[model samples]
Target chain A: MSLLVELSNVGRDFDGGRIVAVDGVSLAIEDDETVAIVGRSGSGKSTILNLVCGLDRPTRGEVRFEGRAVNGRAAWAALRASRIGIVFQNFFLLQSLSARENIEVALLGNLGGARQRRVRALELLAHFGLAERATLRPAELSGGERQRLAIARALANRPKLLVADEPTGSLDVQTSQSVMSIIGNAHREFGTAVIVVTHDEDVAALCGRRVEISDGRIRSDNRMTAMPTPAPTLRIR
Target chain B: MTELTLPLRGLISRPLRTLLTVLGIALAVAGFVALTGLTAGVQHSFASGINENGADLVVSQRSAFNLVSSAVPKSLSSGLSAVPNVEAVSGILLNITTADDAANIVMAGWPSDSFLWKDMHLLAGRIPAPGDQWSVILGESIARALDKRVGDTVELQFQPYRIVGIASFSSVLNQNSAIVPLEGLQQLLSREDVFTLYEVRLKRPLDKNDIAVARTRLIAAAQGFEVGDTEQFSSSIRIFDLLRAIAQTISLVVMAMASVAVANTLLMAVNERTFEIGVLAALGWSPRRILRLILIEGVIMSAAGGVIGIILGVLTMEMAAKTNFAAGLIVPYLSGWSIAQALIFVFIAGPLGALYPAWRATRLLPADALRRI
Candidate 1:
């Protein structure tokens, strides 16, 4: 598989370099792959995900997307808009927008017109079993439903890579399993690669590869020969 | 679904904040509209009064604070009329007095047979006849305010005079004025043989150069007096200048406060929506788009306030025109130019007020913003 994103010896610092968030990290994500990054709180697993998604800039290393070096805010924003999608732990859906509108917003510059965006948003919502709740605002939705809406919004542009920072961190076990199943379905159906950051071993086990980090540095990396067990049938309700 | 949807939703979600901010801007714009409208009305009335009288030149006391304070000797009328190209000259005495039922009524005095009286189109009754000392002609507006008709008695300065005619003039000032024989007014005011100013009419077909030459001759002949053409005299009224300056100054201060209010509201909104903004950025919305969203919100609020303010100001001025204190004194005139000025101000203020907040929103790092609770 071709590499979709590559990070070389990336370092990030805060407070004028007094705090090191990520250090000496080099990683590559290929097309159609599933990778899980696991670490304790503040171990820089989320920071790595940020670098991979171009949400945060590295202080000392080069980050490349689709073989071009990402150098400016505009370049990163363009890449994120067209090629990368991100899901957050808190399900950061716009509270004011309806579920369908939230999805439509992601398609704004990437899509042709309002009508096309609306039709596509509806299709995504119906695929996620959220068609009936398309008019509901994020505040009116349950935690799982909000997360599903967020995921639908992320995939609205059909991004090549999905970067999720603790996709199931705020959900109950059953809901987490259901969300994992949906993520697996997206990977299989869209041929999209995913990078998930989490502390849960069960969540990490669902990915084809696992990378462990400690003290802002990668400690271990492993690739399993066997395909991750097929996710259980998704129960959207 | 459109570009405005998210920003509009954000504003609608915070109903009270949006309303208060709009009201604040509305009040400022209203003040601008009302004060500027009143001042413009004054200038218009003064110019119309001059232009309507068919006066080519006006002679008044030099450096006088206002037309009411200007005094020129009635004896100068003959000399002014003798100036080359001068066709006729009329001496006028002006005063302000309250009638029994009306306050702030303008009283203007002209000769019974002066050409100035020719401009007054009598709607009813006859003009003050020669030797009629206790007769007055009421402008249509003042007649309406006092509810008096021709031949009815109206009391001015504790003295009752018969309304001899109901007349209409082009200017609002004249329309709301009471016209009397110049000698009768001079006798009443105890200033006989002294007039407020002299209105001069040059021969028809005279160009501006001829008028200028005649004005110079009049100035030279009537030493110690200022002689200007109608346009100059109309524009030189100190009270009109003062009113305009005051209106502009007050409007500036009010607009500044409104801009600050808009900025404060937008800042609060940006602060409250930091997380949502981060989500937008993460979703691939560029900083420019985020900035545009915030600006659109501010502009929407300001534009709304501007429309509301214009309506409020017009209504307020109309109401004030009917009040006892302002009756016959203020004519609310709202020109298209004034409305356009107010709109331009609010439009400029919108982006100006939102600029900082939008910049701050753009500066937020998506990762850091998403980290917020």
Candidate 2:
């Protein structure tokens, strides 16, 4: 697999260097790889995810996507538009848009014409099993449904990398398993790279590789024998 | 999806704020239209009244602010007539007074032999002959307003005059006036041998040079008087200029207030949607796109308001024209130029009011904004 994103000794500081969020963190993500970053609160795992996705600029070191340096706001925005997708813990689906429109919003300007975008958005909704709730707004959906809608929106532009920050932090165990299964399915179906930042150990156990961070530095990087395929259906208690 | 989808949805989500902003802009635009329309109407009526008489030149007192306040000696007519190429000269006196059941009635006094009387079309009955002291001709509008006809006695300033003719003139102001014999009006107003102005007519088949020469000669003949063509004379009315200035100033103030209201509403919307905007930014939307979204919302609200305001203003003027207070006096004149001016103001105000808010929205960082709960 080719290297999709490489962070070279990235360091991010807050409050004018008085507080260091991430220090001397070197990480590399490969195409079609599912990696889990595990850390406690304020342990810089989320910061590393932000730097990888171009959502935040590092105070030191460089980030490269496809062997080209990513600099300036315009460059990062272009990358995020076509190459990277992000899913927040809260889902953050636009309340004013319906389930289909939420996915359509991300496809705008990056996809084909309006009609094509509509068709693609409907297809994504159906793939995520949200076809019946296509017309429903985000607020009207359940927590699991809203998270699925967010995931569908994230993949609308056919991005190469998906950066999810605590994707299932707000859900119960059963719903978290369901959301994780969808993420694994997305990786398998589209061959897209996945970087999930979470503190839940069970969530991290499903990935092919695990990286543990402590005190703003990587403590252990381990690779499992294989990435376990998630169950197709949620199992009750 | 089109670029306008999100902006349109944002406005629809907050219907009450959108509605209030539209209403505010509408009221401002309505005030602008009505005030400017009324002033323009007055100016048009004044110019039409002068043009309808075919007067080549008008002569008024140098110190007078308007024709009605002008006082030139009636003897100037003879000297003005002696000027070379001068075909005819007519002297007139004008007054504003309350009559029975009518307020602010325009009373025009012209001699029976004057050329001014030639343009007054008699709708019914005969024109007053010379030496008819108590005879008067009522304009069609005032006749309809007072419900009077030929041989009906109407009292003006407690003096009774028998209506000898009902006449219609080309201009609305003239149509709303009452014409009387020159000497009788002088006797009634106690200002005999003094006229408001003189209307001069040069011989026909005259070019611009001939008129200029005649005007110079007439100026030489009538000293201490201002002489110009009908257009210049109409534009020189200080009262009309003052009314137009006041109307424009008030309209500008109202437009500024509306712009401020639009700005405030947009600022609040931006604040409330900070997280959503952040999400859009994170979704690969550029800063320019976000700015455009906010500006489009403002412009949509303002455009809708402008259209509704124009309708409301026209209806208000039409209703006022039918009221007793404005009967025969207020003629609402809505010109295409005035409507375009209102629309231009609305369009300019839309973007101007949204500029600061749009800039503020663009300044929000995606990471920081997403952190905002």
Candidate 3:
């Protein structure tokens, strides 16, 4: 697999000189890579996720998608729209659009036409077990259900890289496990670079590798032992 | 399936709010167009009247020259007719007095056979011939006011004259006059061979120099009748002043009200559709595209309002006009050109109203917006 995201000697400052959001961070991930960032609050795990996803620029160093130095904010913006898809910690689905339409927004800039985008959005929703809730708005969904819709939105661009910022942040333990399964299924099926940022050890254990962060810098980068697989069907009804 | 449908569906999701905003905009545009249209109609009527009266120079006796009441003697007409560049001399007598015993009655008299009444149109009935000495013509306004019709007799002082015609004239000058044969007027006014005003129709339209020459020849012949310069006539200035004052007043109010309405509605829309707009930006739509989308929505709303308002205002005017509201109620005329003017106002006001709100919407940062949404 080829390199898809590389952040070298990256530093970010917040609140002027008072806060260092990310300090001289260097990270690289390859295609078909499944990695998790585990950090506490103020550890800059979200900042690192942002930089990798092209939603942000490093104050002092460079971020590259493939080998091209994604040239500051404008280029970062272009990549963010076309090449990268991000699911925020808050599950930031548009309140007005339905679950299906929220996914469709991500496809609009990439697809051929209206019909194809709706079909594609529907297909993605079905993969997340949300085909029946296609017409439901964000408010109508459960926390786990909303997170699943966010996952569909993130994949709308058919992107090479998927970045999830605290995907299970607001879910109960069982729902978090279900979201982890869904994330794992996507990573294995698509063979895409998947970077999940989380505060939970169990969530990080689901990834192939876990990188721990402390005080805006990396503390450890190591492979995590995989968790035992849960039973099939496993309907929590 | 396409990306573009996302924005459209999102916008249309809140149907009631979207419709209300559109309606607000349309009403602003329509009101703006219709009011201005009324002004345009009035100006056109005034100008058309001035053009039809056939006066290159209106020689009013400077001493007592009220625009509504100007007249000259018969002897001056012959003398003014013989002036060097003069083509024809038409003497007119205007005795403008409201009836003491009745409503707003105004009595005017001139030779029915002459070209004076030639420019006048009979809306109903025939002209009062000199032979029909006791008959008079009804001005359009007078017909409505006196509720008099053709073949009905109307009173002037104690004498009754048959209403031979109902007519419309070009000018604000004598539009409401109750007209009769000149010989009958001489008998009533107790004057012999004496007329009041002279409308100096020239062969070629007189410039300032030509008018001066005509004035000099008139002063040279007539006694105590000062033939004022043509340029000094207050018709154009009065109309212009009244038009400017009214236009300034109405436009200021309409533009301010409409612009504020447009800005308020669009700004609210930007807030309500926050995430949708952010989604558009996140999907490679430019700031310009976002601004354009908002403005297009605004324009559609305002234009719809403009159309409905115009239709409403016109219908109101039609109802008022059925009973003969004055031609220039504001300037005394309500006409077709007024409708066109109102629509043009709608077009202009729509964009102007959308400008600020559209700019504000386009300036939002996608990251910041996403957080809020």
Candidate 4:
């Protein structure tokens, strides 16, 4: 497998002098791999996802995406728009536009004609069983519906790498299952490199590998030998 | 040239705020444009009123606002006529009188064939014949008000006069004035110098010394004599200038207030849509593009407001044109130039007001914007 992302000795400091967000953490995710960062709040799990997605520049070391350093604004912008997809905790869908427009808007940042983008947005929504609800605003959507829309918007650019920060942190357990299932289907559909920063053990269990962070440093980096089967049983019943 | 569709969506997302801010901007620009329009009209009318003379000097009673009681003896006209530098002098009496219906009208008595009548545009009918004492010339306002036509007879205070000719007005809403023969007004006004003052038409413009030389002779011939050039006549031009300054100052203040309203509304919008702006930035939109997008939002608001205001002003002006309108709603102005200037003012103001707010929106870091989300 090819290396999709490599975070080399990344460290981040905040609070002007006192607090450190990430402490010299180094990690790599291979293409087609599903990785989860599990930790408590502010344990630098979100920070690691942010750095990998090029949302924030590291204070030390380097982040390579597809084998190139992205430290400047322009470089990060290109890396994120064409190569990466980020899903946020709060389902950051623009409230004014419809769900389809939310997904269609992402096409403006990518390479395609208007008609093609529209067709693709519809296709993605239909695959998620949300074709009927594509015209609805974010305000009209449920929490699970919002997370699904966020996932749809993230994949609009056809990114090779997908990074999510607490994507299901605010949802109930049932809705969280629905969100994870939807995300799993999307990851398989696009052959994307998936990385999720979450606290839920079930969410972490769905990923092929889990990396734990403690006080800004990685404490565990291990692969799950056997994936969970609770989701399949719930779907059948 | 930024991707403004997203920013525009942000603007409409909060419709009430957008509407209020846009209205505030429009009102300001309207106030500014309308006032300046009036100023331009007033000044133009005054200048046109005096300059309409092809005359070098206006020989009237000094400082008299009206010519009704300021008549110079008719013999002064003959004396001015004989001066060496003066080519011709026409004595005219302009009286503001009421008809039996109590509507105000201007009645002027001058020699029908004199050059002064030539200065007045003839909309209809022929000039009054000599000894044609009972004939009248109605200005546009009086003609419309009384519903009189050429060959129609109107009852004056003393006698019935035929509406022989109609005189053109500088403005549609200008007061109505009539023209009759000088002999006719002497009888009605009951005075010998029924002619208010003589207008001296000079053969050529005067140099400084010639002006001084002409000044002495004009005063000796006609008492209360004053002379003014085409550009320096304050009596006809200054009132409009003062009015114009007042209008200009008003528009400036309104523009400032409008700018604040626009900026305030945009500032709120920027803060509220921070995440959206960040999203666009994350999507590869440059900060400059984001700035332009916000500025476009401001300009669109300003433009919408200006269009509403101009429509209102023009409608008000048209309505005033249709009625007697005792107070002038349509001031004397250069309409085309004034409206053009007003539009330019709005365009510049819209962009200027949006500058700081757009910059603030652009300054928002993408991560910071998505922080809460």
| Per-prediction backbone clash count | 0, 0, 23, 3
Q: Evaluate every candidate with DockQ and list the scores.
A: 0.74, 0.60, 0.29, 0.24
Evaluated against the true chain A, what TM-score does chain A of model 3 have?
Answer: 0.92
Q: Which ten residues in a row have the lowest lDDT in candidate 4 chain B?
A: B325-334
Stretches of model 2 off by over 4 angstroms after superposition: A8-20, A57-63, A67-72, A172-175, A215-217, A229-237, B54-64, B71-73, B79-87, B100-102, B149-162, B187-194, B200-231, B320-329
Poorly placed runs, candidate 1 (over 4 Å): A14-19, A172-174, A225-237, B50-64, B72-76, B79-87, B118-126, B129-134, B147-171, B187-194, B200-232
Order by TM-score, highest first: 1, 2, 4, 3
Rank by lDDT, highest first. Answer: 1, 2, 4, 3
TM-score of chain B of 1: 0.90
lDDT of 2 by residue, B1-373 (tens): 6888888899999999999999999989988888888777666766677667778998987746755788889788779989989988988888877667555577888888998877779999988988997788988988888889999999875789899999988777777777888988898888797888888999999999999999999999998788988767767777778888999999999999999989999999999989988898889887888888999989998998899888877887777666654544567889998899989999999889998998898888778778787
- Candidate with best DockQ: 1
- The C-alpha local distance difference test score for the whole of candidate 4 amounts to 0.73
CAPRI-wise, candidate 1 is: medium
Q: Write the per-residue lDDT of candidate 1 for residues B136-193, one digit (tens) a residue.
A: 9998988988799998998875678899999988777777888887777888888897
Candidate 3 per-residue lDDT over residues B312-337, each given as its tens digit: 66664445333433432323344556
Candidate 3 interface RMSD after superposing interface residues: 3.3
Tens digits of per-residue lDDT, candidate 1, A1-237, equal: 898888899999988999998999888878978999999999999998998887888988989887878887777888889988898899888878899999999999999999999999999898787899999988999999989888888888888998888999999999898888788777877778988899999988989889998888999989853224435443221
Q: Which has the higher lDDT value, candidate number 1 or candidate number 3?
A: 1
Model 2 residue B59 lDDT? 90
**Model 4, residue pairs in steric clash:** B32-B251, B41-B332, B41-B333
Q: Which tens-of-lDDT digit does each residue in B250-356 have in candidate 4?
A: 77787778888888888887777778888876655666667888888888888888887776666554454344433222353336766676678678877887888
